[model samples]
Target: MKEEKKPYFPMFVDLSEKNVVVVGAGTIAKRRIRSLIEFTNHLSVIAPEVNNELLELETAGKIEIRRKNYDREDLYDADLVIAATNDHQLNNDIYSFCKCMGILVNVCSDKNKCDFYFPGLARHENVVVGVTASGSDHKKARAVVEKIRTIL
Candidate 1:
């Protein structure tokens, strides 16, 4: 018997009122945070220490930064969670927790553990495009996103 892998559907969501939480503050997490902030106002970041840019965003009231280790309590209000920690175990734990809570989760290090994959985005006035290579080729997805951006 063989397993089947279904393609991820292209579903555009409204994040304006959703509570999005990113569980790491490193470069990968930062990029996700940056993209999310453009669409949602209720974004929370949890980590022991974050970079200056995140600190500035916190100071400016764009996102909430919790300067501490991750706990399940931190996700109490999250509608969507991005597990972007460098610690694989931690990311897995977060994924399990999110699953139990029925929360949508993206684990940056493991596609199999993710409930959703972040897409390369292109946004123009009154239009938004999302592109992905199904977690196989990010560079290709980005190139396509760039082309889409130019078209927009």
Candidate 2:
């Protein structure tokens, strides 16, 4: 018999003033970074190849960019960590480190490796909603968010 995965708990966190570390500068990391910057000022990106947009954010003091490979020391001060790098092994290493340290982390590559799943978020002024399909179906989750957005 196969066991089913537990569903993600829906909760709103106050990252408004927390130190959030993003461990990549690729497309997925870029997406998360864009959304997180709207909420936090202490968003740090550690990547070897950060794109122009992230550099611009660093220039404007919205985020701090460290252009290099991720060191485990980065997690020491992070309130929340997003591991969106292309390396699966690195993401797993981060997940394990966060688990031991009791830090919240989201691994973009694998659902089983994630301590938290990033939901499709829709914000209308003060009203914000997040939709997730338990990581089974991302398209459905996105569609649901879009539908909710249309109605709200």
Candidate 3:
């Protein structure tokens, strides 16, 4: 039997001026939002209820917040979308919607639904190392990250 290898494409993206949208305002959503802020200055968060952390970010003028549930129109102006809602169906919906629009999306509920997986990342100064097992074994990925951490 012929073995097939999955394609891996790596690219560096400059999110400095991109318009990124995050759906949901829970803890997971907050984490995703915070990470995005590190790379981009333009961030839009959509959720009916905002958590204290996100509210704080809004108060600091770190990101734009929309107090409303997600709608298809929300993805129109987004350069990237992060579906971090606790509702799995909603996340799936957002993922599908992004696909139809040819937009890059990350679904927190399922890695398979995401166009790109968020790997375990270690940062020191300006150096960042990301580790991933392509969703096959996250534990192994974490182990790899630990090894990388020791070297960095």
- Cα lDDT tens digits, model 2, 1-152, are 99986788998888888999999999999999988987887899999888789889999999999889999998899999999999999999999999999999999987667767778988888798989998788999999999999988
Give lDDT: candidate 2, residue 8: 80
Ten contiguous residues with the weakest lDDT in model 1: 3-12
Candidate 3 local lDDT, residue 86:
89
How high is each candidate's TM-score?
A: 0.93, 0.90, 0.85
Error of 1 at 29 (Å): 0.3
Best by TM-score: 1
TM-score of 2: 0.90
Candidate 3: residue pairs that collide: none
Cand. 3 Cα-lDDT: 0.86
Scanning candidate 3 in windows of ten residues, the lowest lDDT window is 4-13
Best by lDDT: 1
Candidate 3, residues 8-101, lDDT tens digits: the string is 5555688889889999888788878877777888899999989788889889988999999899998898989999998999998999889989
Ranking by TM-score: 1, 2, 3
Model 1 segments beyond 4 Å from truth?
A: 1-4
What lDDT does candidate 2 reach at residue 96? 94
